[model samples]
Target: MRLSRSFLPTLKENPAEAQITSHRLMLRAGLIRQTAAGIYAWLPAGLRVLRNIADIVREEQDAVGAQELLMPTLQSAELWKRSGRYDAYGPEMLRIRDRHERDMLYGPTNEEMITDLFGQIIKSYKELPQVLYHIQWKFRDEVRPRFGVMRGREFYMKDAYSFDLDHDSSVDTYRRMMLAYLRTFQRLGVRAIPMRADTGPIGGELSHEFLILAPTGESGVFFDSALEEQDWLGEDVDIHDRGSLEKFFTGMTSFYAATDEMHDAEAWAKVPAERQREGRGIEVGHIFNFGRKYTESMDITVSGPDGAPLYPEMGSYGIGVSRLVAAIIEASHDEGGIIWPETVAPFRAVIINLKSGDSTCDALCEKLYAAAPEHFLYDDRAERAGAKFADADLMGHPWQLIVGPRGAKEGKVEIKNRRTGERTEATPEDALALVMKTQG
Candidate 1:
């Protein structure tokens, strides 16, 4: 994408309202703009990054046998009432009334609605195990919505619901989801530790919140340092194998990890002094095994093997798709700007035309841009070299290819790694080859 044609409204100075690094960097980098207190309008650059993150999330969910289906942002109040939560859910629920005086609401979560839908189509044990997920916008009336998307009132989320016939099957489904979450966070370039957490309004006896450690995080976490060394993606665990899933889950949970609410002094003392890890962490995802909470309340039932009526056990898994944009920034950014992970980066590399009008530089940049247009963002504007460099760094493309007149004339360009700040001088052909190799 050409900078001249792009709608990036980057600011030179930080906005006073942004209190965190991700919030301040997001504004200065022109990724998002606040339309209301906690609502934001994602711009072109921001939308690209958001879509990339969502795609990765979708792919990971699919890998775990979860099917994708979008749900509406607005839901009938009757659904919540059926689950006995309409009154229990407090002010955060955005209650409304239609012209007909019927109650309605912008859903904060979809447990009740999903249960109603599943009950409608599934009436027998034939569909005993199923996972359905949707990526959509959700709203919560936060009394104090701040820190940009981190605690936004309106944001995008991916919520998945799993239905099984009994407790054993439901536990298996929950274990599979835990594995999926670990892999998803690993691919997003963040080490998210799974810690036992309170279900809060979701009302589940079993729950886990995946947290990414950051100094600006809201909750205090205590975990074993060994949790950081586990390579979830590298582990060989077949999602469809029950024993494999159970073993993997047991292995992962063996580490001492818990949020402040669930912290146990006796357990903490058991860990080696050097292996004790404690810090502030931000929640990026959560999973819950609510069992028959909704099914029992809403009178949802399916036929059992013995032909008896049975309430299906259920579990819900959630990943903060929009909040991840800010979380990634918080976990990865430096003094310059966000250092995006390649998997979720808007573009793999950016090409800077140091001398826009210079025939040599223009020719070199155009050649590189055409080589992989989808993977590169071409800076063709007639801007100073310093400004171009600053903006490139701020956007945090994994690599920056510099084509100055002198280097272009010599048939050489400079390639700089955004994370390491390492520069290499090579011919345009050599640079392209290097960048393409990294793309793999």
Candidate 2:
């Protein structure tokens, strides 16, 4: 991906409309562009990051045995009517009418539709447990859609619905989702703590919101530092084993964690003084255990083992896939620009040709880029060295492979880690080896 051939439209100055750090950086770095109020078009680089995040999400969901299936962006209004929330849901629901005048909607969430669909497919306890998920675009008519993708009216989301025949099994499904969310965030290269939260329009008594710490977050957060020490990917819990999931859930929830709306001074005091952590946090994902709310309201039923009709318990889990792009920037950027976690970085490293037209520098850069053209963005534009350095830092590739004439002439390249600002001069082969190892 050569810069001369790329569509990167980076800005030298911040846009006035961007109020938050993520919003400003996203615009200045040319990752996204506003097409309408609270709506955006993701550019090539932005889409790359979006896809990377979704892939990690998909992998974790698959690991937990959740089946992947895409659902429609447009849903029937009748689905919501059956659940008695069509009108009660208020203006945020983007109500519309087809040419024939049928009531329709761009889905804000998929509970009603998923319930109706699930009821039709599984008719007996023999199909007791099913967890289905989809990643799709959704729209909500936000009265004031602000803060870029962080609070966009239209955005990409990953929503999963789980159904179980019994309360005990349904709770276990909820625990499994909790485990999945923790591992998902951990792999995305951020510390996201699960805090008990309001179910809101989703309507669930049991819910948890995962918030990643950031100074620009909308909510105040308090938790025990111990939550920061665990490595979820390294966790030993077996998703298929009920006792294993139960133990994992208990161990995780044992640490006190809460958003300001649910904060308890009594519980906060109980945490060791050294363990108390207070900061602002941005929500990236949420999970709910609503039991029979949707199933009962939609009158979805299956035969029980005793041969009587039964309503399957249901839960919903959601991650703001697009919003995460912004949330991650909020949590991980510095004065220069975004410092991406390697797992979600659009490109693992960028090849900077300090002297673009210079024979030696161009040759060295081409050599580095050719090794993994798909994973590296090559700055081959005829530009000044200072401008090249600024753009590379602003774009925030995890590493910068510098090819100046001085380094290239000696058959050496300079590699700089964006996060640590560490630079080392090495043979081109050695530099590639180090980066490839880090990437692995």
lDDT of 1 by residue, 1-440 (tens): 88888888778888999999999999999999999999999998889889988988999899989999988999999999988899999999999999999999999999988888998999899887989999999999999999999999999999999999889999999999998898888788888999998988887799999999999999899999988876655457988889998888888899999989899999999999999999999999999998889999999999989899999999999999999999999999898889998888888899999989888889999999999998899999988989999999999899999999889889999999999999999988889998888652
Per-residue error (Å), model 2, residue 22: 0.5
**How many pairs of residues in model 1 come into backbone collision?**
0
* Residue-level lDDT tens digits of model 2 in 299-418: 999999999999999999999999999999998988999999999998989899888778888888889999999899999888898888899989989999998888898999899999
**Over 4 Å off in model 2, which ranges?**
none
Residue pairs in clash, model 1: none
Residue 349 C-alpha lDDT in model 2: 90
**Cα TM-score per model:** 0.98, 0.98
Clashes of 2: 0
Q: Candidate 2: TM-score?
A: 0.98
Alpha-carbon local distance difference test for all models: 0.92, 0.92
lDDT of 1: 0.92
How far out, in Å, is residue 422 in model 1? 0.8
